[model samples]
Target: MPEGPSKTAEYVATFRAVESARPEGERLFSDPYAASFLDGKLRLGAALARNGMGQRLVCRYIDRNWPGSRPSAVIRTRLIDDAVTAAIEGGAEQLAILGAGYDTRGLRLPAAREIPVFELDQPPTQERKKQRLRARDGDLPSNVTYVPFDLLDEGVGAPLERAGFRTGLKSVYIWEGVLSYLTPEAVDQTLAWITASGAPGSRLVYTYVDVALLKQGGEDEPPWSSQVAKVGEPFRYGLDPAKMDAFLGDRGLKPVWDQSTLEAIAQHAVPGGRNAPGFYRVAEAEVLPDR
Candidate 1:
């Protein structure tokens, strides 16, 4: 946002991964290695918040202050994780994560362990992940490759190709928690590459804020936009819900799964959930095979 990898990206270190590291009853899932991405203070807080009200309190405060922040990220992470796992089981190969930031899926997911993991993000943030990863564990996974680049400045196809990404490989392209912060051109270019390069049956998963929420904002835009702006990251792009099916078709992709934060919570039986409309949406789209 301000410089390097987004300041907003750091929250993945705390909110999504770190908290998810708790025991199953406390967490929807766990990411033990995600603790490596967190700083000392975050580590301490997360440790104190490993279960019960302590954990709920942390998320409640964030949700109260910044609506849709915690629930969206948490549900989106779980959804992405499930999608990737299923794809791998179905014989997918290559894995690419755009704006990976502090995500630990490459390390933590069992299906991902044997596959080539290509992570793309800002140079500084990528380096920081490597440093923290090394400090936390000792060595990088042999299958993991880091591509240091900006999607706004450069298209993913070239850099990822240089990183040993093969064309027409059945792969999962993950652009988690990042689209709203990017320019429209960046979004289109990335999707173009994913749709064009993916082998038959490949798919992409990404999260986006609702366009209507930000467009006619009297209540939604003020707090959400300003809160993100305070961290030097502001919402720049969104997908229209009504046009999404056609939108995917235009890019040579087809919608496979779509979930709003409310739906995700309902699916997961998350308690005390608010049915907030115009919040966040996570969608998975399949790359239509070439005729």
Candidate 2:
């Protein structure tokens, strides 16, 4: 995608870097390694965000252009972090992150580090991620495995298995910030694959945009959509949050919880701050035992 690492992944990492730059008490999650994945203007922006004034300036610019992107990423990161930790405590034996671009969970989460963590993404992005990790930490964590494959070209099963992913173990899969760029068929295939490959109690956490917005945008595309399209990645799939239960159920998944960006912002963000767009959301579901 885009001839190299995904630009959107860097953007999400930049958001995390800026959030991590916040004072210890004010930050959602501490991802000290986020800044290591950024470069150029993104790198400078993250550096400037270390202080309150600069943080506001950087965040304001982002909010003005992308609305809820920064806060959504920040809040979703924490949400998924909690879900992953809970999964491990609930007996997850392995963690698989599909489309895992620049995500530092395996390295930052103590619970995740205790078990095998599979990071799967397109080859270019995965390679860049490895290079960045090696450069920043001198060596990648022994617990994390990187699997590279084209998301649009192939199913994740073979690549992941080749990378040491084992089925029949209760697992947690994180497919964050990736659904919108894939076709609906790909999305359905992935959900079904997870059910077929993970144990009965496995969990899958993912983020998606609302289908209404995707279908109703009509002639006027949203700024966020156009911005991402300009960089080669475009929004392609969405699901109605109201139908999440049925949507997951048909694929052998039981919905656990669905949280909108607005909900995440209200629950976790500082009050009177920029509001995250409600249409973007995160949801988690567990693999249903075969009937």
Candidate 3:
């Protein structure tokens, strides 16, 4: 079957846009270009509007239980924000976003203005996102770059390297909402490449669903997950938190933060409502042994 645009991509764009549009006091994080990217997708926009009820439910649940729960969308935004901030602080000259499907961070984040941001994705998806941004008059940050390639293909790393990514310079790598779409082997291979290619102190921020969650199949499934399953790209990979930490530790990387930590940050940022349970876990690791 020919691979067409995944509905999951559209859903993600909508979710981000909704969260971005929230008022300052109520918002967990912001993505200025999210709404722009979904400009023509009336169905998606409508779906997102309808999902507002679910978001409210999630917010209430988080408020009661977690007290300071950070929705997954907020968690992801903060993770990327931290990664970008850390890269800039550590003097990283480049930033790479893997599987950057319709993501607006490259254009929306102010830190991107100084550090070169490279977005790597398939040609078709990248083209579609580029067109959407252009139509929206979204201003691509001056330092942002786009690399089109299939990460699953052999020699996938070459394009990134050619796009000004170096082996010995501080860098930040983000792979949000991506690993679950890939097979286990591919996930490991991608990690290995990042570990091998990145400079000391480089950081990577990524999210993966828990395998146990997938097996149990509870009411916790995000509304978009079932719809995304209709397409061939159901979530497939889950990282055992303990094993994931050890795996990266062996590669000279140390897990510095996780979902719980972000949840705390969110509590402080947007203190009241029920936040969404983290159906997905986000972690940040640095490319050096723990102190």
Candidate 4:
């Protein structure tokens, strides 16, 4: 983990903040707590985004700097939000969010408020989020249990168990914007933990980049790659969307829903007016019963 909070997390929060600032009829989702996690110019920009004109200006500035990143993040957020809601409605008793930096789902989603939420991330980012939440809401939400641990050095099982995560419970895990930052070993370990620790019918909602993009071996890196690398959180893993079903099946998961970033944006965002990176994908999978 970086010495400070995750910059990418703050960037995603800024994306949600900007989206939430849109008029109620036009916004995809509302994350009222998202802006509180931002800093400096981003905080100012989110503040200004409360009006339609300000929203367009902030989006234009973000697009100029990050190309498809803002739209991709926004769309990804809404997709995951829908998946989580569906999971809750399907009887998920718990929610475990891996790399949960700056995410406000536990507080913002009413369905999430009905169950216990485990928010896991690096110590610095977890602390920063909690501090911001306390300042804004006077206390941490009673339903959220923050688990601060280094993803590189530790597996989630022990920490989560210590934090009162019950095994064999119907759970929903959100691995949003986190897989690309982990080593393959860490990723596999996490999957193993989720399958071993969660009961059948549990759900996992995650985002990953196309492995083909990572292995293409060209001078042209994806536009967002450089930015993450500059912040010391470079992408390290991706799954081929073509083989994702087989991959997850081998790991005891059944893929139920999958979509490319472009597809999600097209489905959820205003039509003919949005462009987002297509290499990023989101998937929802169900944990299979052990043989």
Query: Pick by lDDT: which candidate is best?
Result: 4
How large is the C-alpha RMSD of every model relative to the true structure?
Answer: 2.0, 1.4, 4.8, 1.3
- State the number of backbone clashes in model 4: 0
Clashing pairs in 4: none
Compute the lDDT of residue 67 as modeled in candidate 2.
73
Separately for all candidates shown, the number of backbone clashes (residues 3 or more apart, or on different chains) is 0, 0, 3, 0
- Candidate 1 vs 4: which has more TM-score: 4
Full-model lDDT, candidate 4: 0.89
lDDT of 3 by residue, 26-90 (tens): 66667766665554543344334436574565445434533322345555676677677767777
Question: Whole-model Cα lDDT per candidate?
Answer: 0.79, 0.88, 0.67, 0.89
Per residue, candidate 4 scores C-alpha lDDT tens digits across 55-84 of 888888888888888888888888899899
Stretches of candidate 2 off by over 4 Å are 218-220, 271-273
What is candidate 1's CA lDDT for residue 233?
Answer: 82
Listed in order, each prediction's TM-score against the native is: 0.92, 0.96, 0.81, 0.97
Candidate 1 matches the true fold with a TM-score of 0.92
List model 2 lDDT by residue over 63-121, tens digit each: 88877788888889999999999999999999999899989999899999999999988
Best-to-worst order by lDDT is 4, 2, 1, 3
- CA shift of 251, model 3, Å: 2.8
Top candidate by TM-score: 4
Give the Cα error of residue 46 in candidate 3, in Å. Answer: 7.3
For candidate 1, what's the RMSD? Answer: 2.0
